[model samples]
Target: MISAASEVFSHAGKHSQDEIALILQKHLKVDSAGHLSNERRISPTRNQWKYETFSPVWGAPEGLNSKFAPPIDDLKSIRGVRGIPHQSLRSVAQWINSKIIPRCHMEWIVSSGALWIVQLDLEWEETDQGKDPADATMVAEGLRPISTASKIFKAFTPGDRTSWPKLKNLEDFDFGTTRSGPRLYFATAEQLQQALATSGPLLETEIDELTAGRAVLRTDLDRTDSGILNLPRTDTVDGRLAVAWLRDTLPLLSERFGSLSGLAVILHAFLPARAAAWAYFDPGTPIAYVDALWGLPDGLQVLPHDSFQVDIRRGRVISQKIRFKPRFLCEAPDGTWRYTEVLRLKGRSQVLSHEEAIEIGLRTASIAEKLGQDAQIMWFVGIPNAYGVDANLPWYRAREKAQQAPRSARRYRPVPVSKQDDLATLPQGDVMIRLDPEAPLIRDDAFLDEVIRIAQARKLPVELQGSLLSHTYYRLSNGGVPVVLAEPYSKYFRTRGRRVFGKLVRDRVPVGIKAGGEHVSEARLASDDALPGLFAKLVEEGQELLQSSDKDSQVEELSDLLEVVRGLAFQAGAEWEKVNQAADRKRETRGGFQERRVLLETSLPKPQADAQLDPREIKLHEFLRVEETGSFASVPIAALVSKQGYASANFELDGQPLVLTLRLSGSRIELRLEEEPSDETNQGDLFSAA
Candidate 1:
């Protein structure tokens, strides 16, 4: 019996050894002692032991095919095999009756040498007196009205027990057990519809009605008269029975069919022959599906070849094809069959971080910086004008016109132009000049020159002049004219005269014209209304000098007249004439004699005794000596005056000395030589000549 049980265990490909042992112990009564015991008494010790008996003779060739003995009645009734020993055949019979026949198990049917098992479990549900008429109608409709038998039969194949044949009721149905694993109960379409409707509200109510009163029976038991022996039904009496039956029966079937065990349940239905049988079982539930398929009892294994193949493009599964490896299939959260790996692909994920965005911003900033001064202004709709006419032009023109008016009429002068006309007349250009209210009047010559140059380049007319000298006007070739007034000429002449005269006297040079108060007074007298008498006196004096006969006296008077003319020219900012050349020449030609050149004869104040003694000259003298080598010489002196009364230096040297210094002041010198002196005597002779 144990040997037959081992064969059965080996044939049940999916059940673990422990699970098979439990099943055998529960149903076949094959104990660990390798003996078959009846439920009420022990059998006599039967020595049916043979080495070949323990071997799988039902699948082996010689033992069952041997001609030594005819097949025993028990063995024939169990599987119809001719075997060698009666005891051995009886053992096989007990194994078949307890573990194979009643449960519908078979092994090694030999059309060929390949071994295969055909197993089936049948379950019958006894209808109650109050069984819903709706359930009866559902049963009559067929086990799987929506699916073809061939399509539905695959669900009940061995190695899968998580699904089962759904039944509406159990009346006049065979409740026979064979050498199969366990009976499976499945919900009918009506029961499943009710369960689905009760479980989910959003699904259409019609879906609920299609599955009500449907369930599959997973275990075999006698139908007692008492109603307490109730069969499992779908949760909802009206919901779609197919999915609900699958959901409820699959859990129990998977639990009973140990991991990988294979079994099949076939249901009898009133439909046509092609639709009478419905198979139900789960495919092998992966470890992950244990909780979800826990209570299922009739689930058939869905082979890898039976799974649907999906074409994945990009991230989505598009079309399905049969004959691919069975991906773990389970009910999704939405109660639909879904591939677990595909669901994982649909999950949401993030690809960028905040820091990455910040880095992009920094890169943009860097790019903008590299573009440098070439940035262009972006324009938008309806912006106010940035460059407008100078607001101060009206006031400026009014003041200017007022100043131009005669003094008496100026007080009543009106605005030079209306504000609108003033704005309309403003010049337009690419460059805008903003005038500073506190800017000083245009006084710098260079600045004025640039302004004039720019205006000329742009063909804008303008002019330049000192406001105190004279009025100058400029006209553009096109027609615009501007006027500029110089500084007062008289004031410039007086100021220049005072400055030049002061410098000349302070340096002790000869003053050709005086600029003291008396000279100024004389000038004032010449122009003042109160100085007419003085002018007349000066005219009388001039006439007397003109009439004098003594040559010396005449010369003196002529000199005074020459001085007055020079003073006049100097005050007027004109070059002074040493003598009135016109007057002197006239006198010489009229007198028939040449005038003597007095500048050569007159002493020029000894040429300023210390004029050549400049501090820079002394420094030069020291530098030359410091840089001089052997025999190079530097001579220090108090003064060096030129023959023309302009003082500098006279340097004398001999040989190619590095340097020679001629002192012109206590701190000044003049260098003359470049190279070292060969002899001191030669340098001395050069100094003596200087």
Candidate 2:
């Protein structure tokens, strides 16, 4: 499996995705596949050791202890999880490391094949390579000693903050002068304190042109005048999104818990992973890593680069990456402060084997000591630990169990490229659905037609998401688990393909549109019964209509769009008339979209060609929910922005015809293609003319 994956990846680096994928399919075979548990995964860290009885041992290939393999399935039964019985040793390690649950359910992605007793380390400082268990510490002093062990790890570089261009106030923020859509503002310390004193603390909005269509993240969160709410590092889009979360979360939390500690606890309860991400900046480290740092705090500061060395298990830590320090310094109830190494434990593991994480944490503490900081070491977990520390605390501030919203795990079905180069277009909801006269695939959508009927009756648009845009996959089901065989997909293949079809099958003539992305999963569309997904589908369909030049289709699509709008309004707890009146009031200021207007200028990033991006256009933090994913990390920023429902309007700039395309991938005005550089007359300048 590794060889096949390696070959496919290597080929993918140089060739068009479709061609490379074809080459891979000719040579490769499927092993296993399913949803990744990485959404909530955390890199293991240090402090003290907590032990539990180990579960019954499971067998796997050499050097990989079955006790510490990659995780298995999270869903009850994924569709087609198994292709072959065993995978690579690497997969096994990842499975164990991820701490996937219900060991009895270990039934997918046999990531490794090599067989041997996995050796483990007792404890030792560390090395650039694997740790030998014999040289490591004694496990409680009674356990069997490990002779040897092998490890595989991954690392990442911290985002560069240089392009997070400093803007002192909201007034200076303008992603695009003409395209700036929604924005949020920060609350002053005085305003926050004042709000806190009121019966119901309320975060207010400044009400400016930027507030046009954006929702306010009004929260009741408050702190003293001297205390600052340490915001997570975010570019424009992510900052707005963070505010959106605060708007929704703060109010509910305000009514639930009366104390700051309660807020901290519930914050962890509601969104544990996000809360963890926030902890890096939170001066108090309130909810996450509670008790890791205790005391009258000095302030929060990030450690300079080159402070810690990276080893194999440490993954690939970039030398310049900033590491926040004083991570352990905190004041206890007695008002005295302490610095401690914090060991993080996963809640899912009944028997925790995180000696490596602990070692790393201790190593980090020692590094801090060398820096001349007086700090100690401790341990923390997703929940209170085996030692019962903070167990009695009001961590769960909810009056009753909060039914966390089901995570959005959208199901995908393969959609084939109907015509490899379909030029014939037919009207479908304003956007022309293209097909080829001499294509290999046959069209049959009786099943889909019925599905659409039911969807329209329910006032929902059929959702459509492109497949892994950069790679194409052949998916099949085995024992209710989804299995995938993937190869490269070209940038052209992704953009040209549209719509979707039923699942893939052997010798199938063809399917629907060729949706592409870096993901290996099939393109996804909500079933008839899926309402939430339909809302987005409707909005997408509406965008397609707006993109169309067909007047009749545009009118019809507009009606369909209005209907979707009404459905959205109902879902958002607003009446149709109220929405209509609000629209009317807005039109009184910014005129409605009557003429097909072309936006010519913006302060947002404009890339001449796909590359590192003019720093102005590069956003380090997520702006849209889509940016939150690493799936399209390598996809060109243009493609990402193109997904935003904006039309590539052609206009004249400085006496030259130029295309001013809106970068819609981010939630708001993010980037633009200043000029189509492909033209014969000049080099494409993203913003300025030749």
Candidate 3:
């Protein structure tokens, strides 16, 4: 039956014997009386119980201690008085006498894997209520050697242990029951005050407020025992003390508790790793030191992926090795320090590292120390190459060179020679010579024809009679060319002749006469004798006339006269080698006259040629032609002067009254001088000798 039970036990894995019994009792039909009666057949004899106790004596190692013996006979002697089987009696004795409870001095192995030995340092406060023996034993095992009950009593009671009275029962003594009573500890008030002197009275008060009057117990917590402390623990006072120490030592961390909480929230939200796998704490130190170590302030939070080293001494943080990179510097602005999966180079080549940043801070401090209040400091981060340093550097000179180079390379090829030659060609048109009728007959077509004749006679290169005479009858005697001639009293002659002729018939004086009568009507004869001399006189007279006119009028007249003189002189003196030279020189200095003449002479083709002159020279020549003739020579002077009071009958000439009439047509004046009957020179032969 026992083998069957063992076999069942083996088959059922970890099932209990009770469970097997229940299964058997439920499945198999057995009377209870019979079951009990059958159990006796399978049982060992009465001596076997004693043999069970003695078996270790023969099979155990030779030197093993035998202190585990049970007091079986004493239990049996007591149990025999109460009726039972002998084997049952022995079983009862073995069970009752077994070493179930440990001795007070023996070491015990804790369920947490730690070995604990009972020490003499068990400390307890005497109370009206007795201490539990189990609690007392646990405390003894946990405490150090010097924390014994007697020493604790002496320390708490303020008396010598030998002098304290011994009581028959602990409950009889009138002792305090509260745990708040004083106890022995290393951190005394005086020592605490001395240690906190530099931190000022506030810190001292804080420390005192946190720890004062509290009973302190010392215990060494070792990691080998899996003894670990967390932020929250069963000992509220100790936990609060730890928290207060952190807060006081690291004020910035306390201030940034919200940031830390936010980081925790982010971690929780993302769950990048196992929940609650890591923790953070204040590394009690100065803010500057923290800033230096972390390359920033305590507020500069980070999302580290693994275990990290926080050295309170150096105020530095070093993270553990991790496959995942630090995704972000949590305190930086959004996106500035964001993580990206794309592989890229990072570190010193990327940005300033924490160490470099701290070194920069130190250098900055040194510089600030030297520069004092005048110093200004600025900080920047990121790859140096990412900035537009090179792009922004001045390129003014380069730009200027670039701009100028293209312009300079644009070659300015000279205008084609053919185009220039084409431009140089004379233009074809009529050359109109505007004549002033009042101008001397020496300036008439007769003179003009003489000039042409001379030019022809000399075979000079010139265009003659090709010129158009304006403001007069068109006449040139040498070739019978149509010349403009002025009527005796036409507005064209009357207006122009008034200045030299005055208001009399004798006013029509000949040219070359200077306010004198001998030179009258015979002016053209001088040219017959000496053409050059006559031309000299004419030029002199023209110059005087030009000078006499109003400045504006004089410029105009002089300009016109220069054109005519240039042409005529060129013709008359064609036989002379210096004629063209003189004409050209005069043309060059004659205001804008010569330029206009050259232009017209070339462009108009003497009313015979075919090509046109250049426009610039044409404009100049037009100005010269208009200037040579005074404006309005064809307008009658009498129309300008009052004629209302003049006689309406026959007019007289040389004091002889004659029948005559006077009339005006447009700009012309008409006068009729009739013969008067006279008894004097007209009477035939009366005074003549027979």
lDDT of 3 by residue, 1-690 (tens): 689888877877665555544234323221110001101111222122221111111111111111333334432233222211223333332443253221111111112222122121211122113222112111111112222222101232322232111111111112234311122322222223334454444432332332331212222112223222111111112223433443453333224332222110000001010011111121221111111111111111121122222332233433222222212221122211122221111110212244433433343333334333211122222212222121111000000001111001101111111122322332333222222111123223344444345323433222111111111112233233323211111333212112343211112434434444222333333344444544544444454443464787777667655554554555465644476577678767875443434422333236666554454423221223211122222322222222231112434457766643333322234454347643333222321331
RMSD of each: 54.9, 35.1, 62.5
Best by TM-score: 2
The predicted structure with the larger lDDT, 2 or 3, is 2
lDDT for model 2, on a 0 to 1 scale? 0.28
The true-versus-predicted C-alpha distance at residue 399 of model 1, in Å, is 99
TM-score, one value per model: 0.13, 0.17, 0.12
- The TM-score-based order of candidates, best leading, equals 2, 1, 3
lDDT of every model, 2 decimals: 0.27, 0.28, 0.26
Q: By lDDT, is 1 or 2 better? A: 2
lDDT of 2 by residue, 294-391 (tens): 21111111110011122222332212112222123222223222333322222212111233233333333332334343222222222223222221
Clash statistics: count for each candidate: 115, 69, 25
What TM-score would candidate 1 get against the native? 0.13
Distance from true location, Cα of 351 in model 1, Å: 57
Stretches of candidate 2 off by over 4 Å are: 1-535, 546-549, 595-690
TM match of model 3 to true structure = 0.12
